[model samples]
Target chain A: MAETKTYREALREAMVQEMERDENVILMGEDIGVYGGTHLITDGLIDDWGPKRVMDTPISENGFTGAAVGMAMMGMRPIVEMMTWNFSFLAADQIIQHAAKLRYFSGGQVQIPLVIRGPNGGGVQLSAQHTHSLENFYGHFPGLKVVAPVTPNDVKGMMITAVRDPNPVIFLEAGALYGTKGEVEDGDNAVPFGKARIACEGDDVTLIAYGRQVNLCLRVADTLEEEDGVSAEVIDLRSIRPFDEDAIVASVEKTHRAVAVQEQWRWFGVASEVAAIIQDRAFDYLDAPVERVSGAEVPAPYARNLELAAFPSDKQVANAARRVLYMEEK
Target chain B: MPAENGNGENGGAEARGEGSVATSADRLVDLYREMVTIRRFEEACQRGFRQGKIGGYLHVYTGQEAVAVGFLDSFKEGDRVITAYRDHPHALLLGSDPKNVMAELYGRGSGIVKGKGGSMHLFDVERGMMGGYGIVGGHIPIGVGIAYALKYHETENICQLFLGDGAMSQGAFHEAANLAGLWGKDGQCPCLFIVENNQYGMGTSVERTTAMTDLAAKFDAYGIEHEKVDGMDIEAVLEAAERLTEQVRETGKPYAVEALTYRTAPHGAADFFEKYRSKEEIEEWRQRDPIGILENKLLDSDAADEEKLEEIKGEAKELIDEAVKFADESEQPPIEELYTDVYSGEDEYTGEA
Candidate 1:
């Protein structure tokens, strides 16, 4: 039977199950073991897996992450948790240079099959430097795949898939969704890359989102039905590299309207790209110009009120949907 | 960990990094041939690029053939070899078909990396050529990770990593080196870092780029056993590779070799010769060219005559010409192919929706 679990718990379970199944499936990151992960994502893993499998490394992202890349090249399935997206910048050279391009440059002889994952997105006063979007930063690379899982089911499934993937994968977990719970497959569940999931079905307008923004978009969809009678279909984009443009286009073709909701800044955000793709491939079906509900273009603030203002919420998504539904320009 | 390698599955011995014994002149000559092939291949690439027969960032390893050939001499059948973008010579020496390498340069499907990799990146995993990386210091960590797998799979294989002087300054090199040293001490590492200190990292001298010009000395900070070798001398390099690889297998320790060599050509065909270095310095390095030294030695030893050398040159030219023709006739990768291989060929995972 499928059991309900939190995002963090589901992630931990995925790692544990994979480690149990394969001996070479090891994890290395900052405080991932006995420290139980800063987000408690790896709680109780050290005792079960021991020091070799669950490594709590030094603060050197470039060091440990590069080492993990090395290990991955040699056929070990290494999962490197960056602790947070903010810290990955320090190891950007290794991630972009070595991990991502190894396969293509090596003439396809080697497989990085390395996953660098951690909490992403800004919320609850995690100010400035700690709060930035990486969709654009890492998405710029060619060989690497960028994934952001929102639901617990997605968390478990995608993590398993990331472990098995031969290329280097950057798995971004929405920090806000760690406590959110959901039901997952009973055993050995794995979700593929480059696929989008439709969270809710609607007809009037489509709300495309990913990561934590799915929850926010779902809330907006509910509000649109109650107040405006606008049926907003929600599309949860799972993979960014092999982006599901076909899904988004198909959704827009049916709805004739599109509103992309993102927790990241609007400028060059994933939402902006989604809107562009919709307009590019499915522009003829559009009832109105696509609108984007994105986080404010500024450093995330430490203050609770300012932090709330920095990111998109249900009100923003609903308003964006309304704008797309109507002839109004935004 | 309770016997973590539960699958009991492993790749070929080449991936495992195993070594084999050799005390014969035939093998030595074969190693020399490998070096000769690399040297000839590099000169051809330089000529091809100058004539607009190639494209992209082409980093040549003309003067450092001995370093690659020597290491491969000691590299057991199961060992792994990874290096930086300056990788044409490495591929040739590691049993990669010179014609295929040239085909790759011409963008042919028959190339070593199926024409996907040009001069900078070439791969042959079955032959244990891990990769030819584009980024300067990027592949060092990858080499270390391969070593980790050798140990993980309970194999006595070693990883031989090649990088240029510029890569040594990259933080990835330092961090990976330190960790390889630490983990290796406890038996989870089997890597050797070979810094091809060709004096310049794209025009800028090592003395100008790094404070510690002694590249081998930098490994001392990471606690890896390191030594300096005359990269031009094939015998010196072979002896060092044998001793260093043995040390790695026995102690599970990491070592670094600073092959003091020089690049005879510009950083790439795109680069103009006058921007960074002086003509005099370039001329001086040319006087001690690895190929010239070998040619002189062969002439003195009577192991062969000038006619044999000419015949070797003729064969090399014909092979390069054939490679170019094959690559020219080969098809470019299809548009659909762009999405494939971004992940492993895992049967359990479906990447395309």
Candidate 2:
């Protein structure tokens, strides 16, 4: 029987299991020890493993982040939390300049088995400063692996793989999905990165997304099938850096149309990359231009109504799918 | 507070003539030879830059050789070293192959980093030389992190992080210093912060950059032990490094050493105007040149004759000549190599997008 668990529980399970497996695996971040993390995802971990393993750090993002990179080089696996993805800007130099490019620059003499993870995407009125969708920002770099797992199973499985992988990983967790429940397989369910999960199979149009947007795409696919009588295929691009272009191309070939979605701003966003890949590899199979549904181009506002409008919705995803299928108005 | 003389406890008379950390007469001669090699290698770099053979920013370690050599001399096995862009000397001192170092500057596959890092990003991991970072103050935190790992792994070795006077103003330096100070309390951090106070931060003098000219005093804010050393004197730097490095290893605490020195060369090859400081000031610092002090010490102490010094110079010249020949004869990295090494699991990746 499949075991059901929340995203938060699954993430905590991943860390707890890894720490139990390897003594070198340690967790470090602000409030991660005493307060059990800013999101409470690491709740009771400190009590379980003590302060040395679940380290509590000061609010020195660049400092702790760079320290984790150094630890990784010395054969220690460090899982550094950013508290929020917005605060990661403080550690961008360490993350991008040092962590991402160290192994390549060092000619593969060093391997950074480091994971920098935290909640991302704008929702719940976090406003401009607190909210960010950094998949595109992190994925743009070559050496780093960027993974955005949508479900509890994917997050738990991918976290295991990320900790074990001998390269730095940017694990962008969705804050809104922490409480979302999903059926997760127990015991050694490590998911391989760069593989896209086909959430639903259809023939009319392909709905592509990742992270929290995958849930929206799944819901939209159902709506398209029931209300609009259109069968929409949904593809969850779990890993962004090692992009699953073959899976996307194959899905687009079957569907004959595609609609990319992202919570980041429209310009130069993850959707832009997805649309480009579809066009590049599945150009002949397309009956119409691939439509893109992305977050509005504005700093995330504080107001509830405005914040809701800032990000993509099921309605928007369904409309974009219709547009890709040439069934909705231009 | 003004910068005080670093050799008070050790006594300048004993430390200056005979290094406190057992600098045998032969070791002093060897150190002098290493310094000479760095100077000649950088001079070759200048000529190569003029001829358009070496591309990108070339920041040489001509004036601050003693800081790298003296401090690195104290490094034991398993000790890791990280520094900023003025890195050729550090790599050489830490045992990076001269041929690979020169070939890296030439962007050849035979270079230490397979010509990918170029001048600013030299790395010899096997020798525990972590990297030569391009960004100012960027490697400071990484240095602290390395120390944390060393302690966490229950290793006895420490990490030496090198930054410049200009990097003192960066937030990363302060943040890293604070973390080092905090982590050191638990005996989990053994990192040494070495600031190469080369009088200028790429044209901005130390005096103009900060109200507090004493860079060592800044470490007090982070609760780290701080001191200033006479960087021009190799013996003084070695004495300080020996004391501080031992303290770091014994206590597992971070320490800061501000080596007061001057760079005779411009910040980079492109920065030639020397408009930032007066020529008279330049000539004055040049008199206290690190190589000159060691050479004079070697001569005055009767450890070596002028002929012996010249012989060392000739050996360095010959080694540099071989480095240049190897770099010139080395092949360029193939176009296919550009795609490799980005990710570890190459076979698993399709390289499709």
Candidate 3:
């Protein structure tokens, strides 16, 4: 019973407590039942789940996300949304060939447990066709899980493990942190998926990030320990396709330097798979080559200082955490 | 809001001259032995893709076996079926197991997707046959989201889906026919779609793709309810799949039929030299051969002869030669099943950290 809530009211109280403890969940998209979700986070949820479990579809994002992957291949736990992950590139072939390869081409006999969700990167301007970070385009698919939570208690505990994970998740969220806020934790809080939290800890340099670039890497790890005494740390990832990567190689083996950050755009981003998983398993505990930052390969600009120079900033993640801590250079 | 269709012109030659005038004689000899076991399991998947034992691309549903045996013999038992990628006669007419659809076209490990969806994906989904889709109007919004999950599980079950005719100029089939015409305006879309119109998409036809080639009047611009049968007539596609699956299970809505039909091979099996189309328009649709018009309607009603359709084509070539010796003694999956079902719960959700 801790309250606070606002990442769009904890993503609408995690779809109103999983649509009141599942009657096989539901909630389709496109003006999410009576104009409540163009980011109103499913507003008054079709007046408490009516229109047949709050459906309201028709802008046909690949026909209601391929009819929420045919109502999640018959067992129904739907929850589609996609009002923007830049219009989910019009249902990217029913989310990469039928909600991520229909249970390995149906040998596992189907279980899409679909989630989808919406709002992805590029702050406000909404220029390049309603911006999009797409966590490395849905964690470069392979059945898909891809979380990206960022707070308000990890989007209501990872929207209850992407509505009880059977498969297809993607989630993302963060249209400029829907009125930010934080605290959350109420009931049946569910978060598990590939873990990664350590949002503030510190060492000489860790950083990393996730949706809303983990509050700009916790405000650039609090201005690099209050203006350059330098502690850093941060982390936040919160699932990018089952990516805890042992909490990012144990935070670059306890901050022997790393940076990452995102918003999306530095060539194949999610900060280039967190700087190649911190140089593939804390390469001799990194100390240097792991920098990243991202988001300005163009296309998200409609002015306002060219969409604040296309994004990524707290002075470019404090200059990539002062060039991975060696105090600036490479 | 378009619904009221009717202009399906000659509605598939008036449902192939009045739907086989009350057919019987043992369900037209079990629909001419399941359309000669899908033309002998797609001519043994074109000799197992010319003996390399089939791997990847092999579309062939050859002249679309009476639109997958007249709408999977009018579905019903927990109705469901989906298609695209000329799926080996919609998984040998929706019951799969022809040695697991020839060991999922010889990829093996008792195939039927255990061979992880080979020839343009193939699934069984416990006999509801919910897959085949190798993109092309990608499973038409997954058959309007499996008829919106069989009307969200209250089930009077329904979902036909199949695609082709270049997936009716895909925008994922006009956004799954406008959300099965807006969730069938509250009957919660039961879905049917079908289309098939085999006119050619790979070698581009349907009058070079669409100036409104009336693919059942494009589901009357998405208000759904459409028609147009005669897919080389298997009793006018089982009397329009028993009157559109009993009017989509009594009004759960979402229909559309189309059929028309023509692909007598060459959209795969490495599309032979047959440039676009010709050879007398593929010998005039091989004289409307839906198994030679049901063996000339079972010898004009003697109810089958020519040595009983040559002993039902010698028991469909000895059940496709024991499904090609049970897919040449099955088993190939190994390599630790290349990391099982992608991700459904631990195997460390794959991408091995």
Who wins the DockQ comparison? 2
Give each prediction's DockQ, rounded to 2 decimals. Answer: 0.50, 0.72, 0.30
Q: What is the C-alpha lDDT of each candidate?
A: 0.79, 0.88, 0.80
Off by over 4 Å in 2: A328-330, B1-15, B18-22, B346-353
- TM-score attained by model 1: 0.88
> Which candidate's TM-score is highest?
2
Q: Which lDDT tens digits does candidate 1 get at residues B169-279?
A: 888788788878878768778888888888888878888997878889888887887889888766667678888889988888888889888877778767786678888
Better of 1 and 3 by lDDT: 3
Model 2 lDDT tens row, B1-353? 11222222112232144345656567778889999999999999988888888999899988889999999999899999999999999999889888999999999999898878899989998899999999999999999999998998899999999999999999999999999999998888999999999989999988898999989999999899898998999998988989999999999999999998999998999996468889999999999999998877766655666777778899999999999999989899876667666667543352543
Candidate 1 lDDT, A247-284, residue by residue in tens: 99999999999988888878888888988898789989
User: Between prediction 1 and prediction 2, which has the larger lDDT?
Assistant: 2
Kindly list the per-residue Cα lDDT of model 3 for residues A1-330, writing each as its tens digit: 888978898888887888898888888887887878777888888887788888777776877788788788888888888888788887888888778988887777887889988888776887887887888877888998888887888888898878988888888887788888979889878889888898888888888887777787888788777778888878887888778878878877887888887877888777777777777777997768888878888789777888988887688789878876767622
Between prediction 1 and prediction 3, which has the larger DockQ? 1
Rank by DockQ (best first)? 2, 1, 3
- What are the chain A TM-scores for all the models, listed individually? 0.97, 0.98, 0.35
For candidate 3, the clash count comes to 2
Model 2 chain A worst lDDT run, 10 consecutive residues: A321-330
**Can you rank all candidates by TM-score, best first?**
2, 1, 3
TM-score of chain A of 2: 0.98
Q: Which candidate model has the greater DockQ, 2 or 3?
A: 2
